[model samples]
Target: MIIENFSSEKRENKLNQLSAEFVVAGGGIAGVCAAITAARKGVKTILIQDRPVLGGNASSEVRLWVLGATSHMGNNNRWSREGGVMDEILIENLYKNREGNAVIFDTILLDKVMQEENITLMLNTAVSAVQKADEKSIEAVWAFNSQNSTHYKIDAPLFCDATGDGLVAFQAGAPFRIGAEAKEEFGELFAPDEAYGHLLGHSMYFYSKKTDEPVKYKAPSYALKEIEKIPRFRVIRKEHKGCNFWWFEYGGRRDTIHETEEIKYELWKVIYGVWDYIKNSGNFEDVDNMTLEWVGNVPGKRESRRFEGLYMMKQQDVIGQTEFEDAVAHGGWALDLHPADGVYSELSGCTQWHSKGVYHIPYRSFVSKGIDNLLLAGRIISASHVAFGSTRVMATCGVGAQAVGMAAAVCKELGVQPADLMEVTNLKKLQNELNLTGQSIPNIPIRPESNLLTQARVTASSALTLSTIPFDGKWKKLNVSSAQLLPFEANTAYAFKVQVNASEKTTLEVQLRKSHNDKNYSPEVILESQVIEVGAGEQTVDFKFESSVADQQYAFVTFMANPALEIKCSEKRITGVLSVFNGENDKVSNKGKQTPPQGIGVDEFEFWIPERRPEGENIAMEISPAIEAFDVSNIGNGFVRPWGTANAWVADLSDTKPTLKMEWDSEQPLSEIRLFLDTDYDHALESVQFGHPEEVIPFCLQNYTIKDLNGQVLFQQSDNYQTINAFKFEEGFSTKGLLIETEHPSSDVPAAIFEVVCL
Candidate 1:
């Protein structure tokens, strides 16, 4: 059945006028991040989302956790380093709801992009058709919103198809491929010998809140009762909370868009039926009131229309067989395929292929070979079915988004087409820019540490022998005291160096043992045959061992008997300090040692600031202040009270007037300062100013400016209107004294700052 709204007139007036330099179609994670990246680079960017919210699948509608690389990968792995806008979103969300689970993904992501002034968001809008003057380039695109019955004709120099489904590419006449490919085409190991009308399945996620009281539930009409009797379906447990492609029983070998709607309805039926069986069958008698919390409105799509670009990513490239000069992104997810027959079967088993480290994703995969300006990102990038399976994860898609966004910015700046940016020089520049923003670019090798053990010394009463070990040079000798213990653990191992002032040849036996029940367990010492030689300055030794304690326990070894040796023992002790607080008004102390007033407190504390000072004042102090837990109505009021200052004031501090200062031990370079203000209280802050004292200019500037203490302007902005405005300083610039000048006089506005963070 084809349905068309013939009476609906295109209301063009409701559409926002095209004024941005770049336009991003789709408001999913990739689209939002793309828009934010472009806007952060000072480009006028407009983000168009078909839904009312941002985050496509990872939103409240889908509720998918954001997964990155495998656990064996390094912390700074390729998938983990896709920063820029994505990092900002994660940091903001993590800071806001540190204790809560990862349920606030959509709200946090949306707020990040929506908060940016340069990013104009158009929600509930769908791209209808592309208007191109030339076959190679897009002049403008027409979009319509059903809610408002409006059509938008957006014109921009550069365009990004972050629409997960390749909607823009398809509408723009870009050649694309969908479903699985034959093995000979991409030579994918998992691909069938011949092309089959099959593709990965989509899933509709649902969540249930556990309870104690029994609640009855009814199975849906479409519940697969007969299929449940099958061995494959019977063997699988339905008690687990998460259901991905496994719930994908059907919807293959059909029109994806059309089948998706029907699949969603069927999936919902199965989901409710499972819940009903659990509630009524007495199996979940203890689980009372197990109500459905969320049912995914948007299906988590696995396969889609992949646009054919200058280069097509193949399975061999993903298997680490090929490398490219224009590599801009990488992926490492397994090639997981769902059953094509729409029923649980053994063939639905997921396939895994190991790529040693990161695999390259070329820049040519972004823009279509058929269309010049249209750059496709996210899961819709040009890749064979098997390759797409690996690169289709959210983390890999984020990397692709970063590449496309940076490419779009470069094209807009250089006045070149997307295809033209694939040259070595241009691609290198793009890679460098992405790297600076902390985004991972593939094939650019990472040099390992030359020396892992730097200045290693052993402090023990017994004689010890040190041996040089060979392994991957990439491992850095992390500070032993900085190692963090996992949950259900008490202590961490300590290792360090010892120096002998006086020359005394002594036998020192180094040992490794478990410290439990107030006694050493399984003690093993590496004894030296001869007396160890000691130098006048310092004797360095390196030793590595693992603990055998169970349940994430810790162990440390001490000399069995104190051996007489003229040496100074330097053992590495845990340096990080943890503090707990009672309430907003209570003072926080370190293990009941030093009590400090806690106006603003945090549950967990990890201080990385190189320097600390009052926002305006320059006097510095070296104090490892205890991290406290407190709550403030506003962040400005949450700070340690300045000497002789009583109340919080909002004044135009951009100019030299109304200066404040903070003193700390070290010097920390600041990119931006976030001032959390209590807008609900007094509604102060008409206009604010901030800059270093050196660049004193007595003018009521509308935007904040980054300057040195000597008053040299580094950067300036006029538009960000959020209360948490981050004044970013240019590279190679350092400034002190961030003044908050207000639009109204200090006497008129009563705004208070809760917290001031420089990141």
Candidate 2:
């Protein structure tokens, strides 16, 4: 290498011009999912992220757990975990990184994006300028990378702004809102006043580890010296670490976008001050050996600029559970909002209100109002400040962004603007495309005509008859009210016998309950109540319910809290069956029931949640005149997940070699076969910090084989953990009949499948 001589000239980085069919800004979960989905749809796409890694707030730099519809199973959204590309990412994370290391998660996101050949990923690159083809549409975008000293100009027909702050949309002259609206604006009763808070704040977290030797920490002169200034200082405990301190926030009243760095500095001072108290203050236990392992330099921003779109989601759309005609995605995280003062305020950290069921988000919310070629993703989507509280969660944003990505493909195919896809016929096509990929749009089932499996005569080896749930000698304490959610048909009578051990003579209060909305799992409709007197020892209690409903629904056989009794639990785990407890999950809900203030425009409901794996065992009980709901014909029912019913065909527990056969009238050429398996959608797969108990969902089929008419094996797989297992033949084969043999995940859990598609 040779030294260069100084010259009297200005130096500029090399400029590069590139073009793609679709362009996505921001490398957060939303943008990553959008770019991946678009690429998979055969669209040439470019993903640009300013950060060094993907996942935005969910990245290692700012580690926030990824949560969505299930809301950590803290509410009544049964089987409501998001599906599609987002689901694949979460499942892969669980399979390889169950420990939930944020850094490991980063690699997983990168790996997923790399797997798609149509995608070009650019990391550590920020979009600096927006070029408009006209006053209403985006023509291209300009980005710069300091690390490489390069500038890029990317042109595209369509653009998606998933940059969290709506940078692209903002620069393109798209309309956006920065603060909360008054109650009169959208008729949102939960709308906060100006003094309470208009926007959610930014938060920073730190990780600490215990060392063999004592470690000392010294606060800098700039670090906050007075810890008592924070109103909720007493909430800090020696055990509190990482995301547990999500309330360590500030800068909601200030400009969230431009003042981000200033807010981050304030958060650092607060974190250092809290650590200084933990190490030096006399209010804690033995923390002498505890040392700071990692502290986030970047703050996780919650609220920023929310852009305007074709339609703006409002408060009623969430709480009322409105079903949109052009529904593309769903969200169920509580309508959670923080005060303007953040950590400094005395308000109870956040005010949360949950819906009885998941609500639909329309496609119109993703298209920019005035910008023709621009699309909105992530927290920047068109939504009122009231609705943004729930839609702002990462997983919800991811699923919605998936819709945007898919819409881009449809737009390109039709050669139309985003708004054109909103037409009834075009919208249905878009929805069908999304459903084909397993995206869950609430209240919308797959269309039967599209699936070749629907044309075949379906038959199974055996079907499960709900006769009894055998006890495994394990007793579950009735310290919290528990219930068994059983699906029942209309005009059916069911009798159950439960075994319970009582510490003393007590009255066991049992109630039969169901949701007012048959599709929801909230136990709001109490059909009947029975009180049984128990002796001082183990005994059996018999109860019966005669249903007189018009439609099939899940009934909650609830046993109210009685500390003196312990109910028997079954080791057998089955598809579409779960045991729930009315309890508190501090992560989402503080109390078992949500009793919002009267005018808040939110419903009051009790949270019946299931425990995670190795703990969420069903209550053991015997039912008279067995219920037969898992029929082989369910495989072509069009619904993939539990919707009002199991919507799955489960084989008998004794049938070790479970098989499903499909026969056609004539020989047909099959090129590809897709199977949708059960993945315990109830389990919230948080991407980081919260580790899962198991790698694979217990209900998934671990091993499976597919054969032609003469029992000759065509395809087989082992160690499968994903929900969608697909097989394709390079050269298609003609078959009169098809057979699928599957092995159960374990002996106790029966094999189950939702839907099968042949192409």
**TM-score, every prediction:** 0.60, 0.98
Q: Mind giving the per-residue lDDT tens digits that candidate 2 earns over 278-349?
A: 999978899999988999989999998999999999999999999899999999998988888999998889
Q: Candidate 2, clashing residue pairs?
A: none
Which structure among the candidates has the greatest lDDT? 2
Candidate 1 lDDT, 1-759, residue by residue in tens: 998666677633576557578889988778877787778777788898888777786666665554443312211111122344554454454345433233455667767787789888889998888888687778887888888877788898888998877877887788988777887776665677888767766676666776666445667678655446333544434445545324544456556666789877766766666666556555544556676666666777777687788888877786543668887775655444566645444563444443433467888888788887788878898888877877787766776788888888888778888888877778777876665454534435211121111111111111101111112112211111111111112233333332333334444443443322211111122211123444443345333333333423222222222234332321111111111111111001112111223421111221111010111111011111211111121123322111111112332222233333332233445555544332211111101011112111111123444444455555565533223345555675444343333232122122233345455
Off by over 4 Å in 2: 2-6, 193-197
True-structure Cα RMSD, model 2: 1.4
Q: Candidate 1: misplaced stretches above 4 Å?
A: 1-19, 71-81, 98-103, 211-213, 227-239, 243-249, 283-285, 442-759
C-alpha lDDT (0 to 100) for residue 558 of candidate 1:
27
Instruction: Provide the lowest-lDDT 10-residue window in model 2.
Output: 190-199
Task: Report, for every candidate in turn, its global Cα lDDT versus the true structure.
Answer: 0.51, 0.91
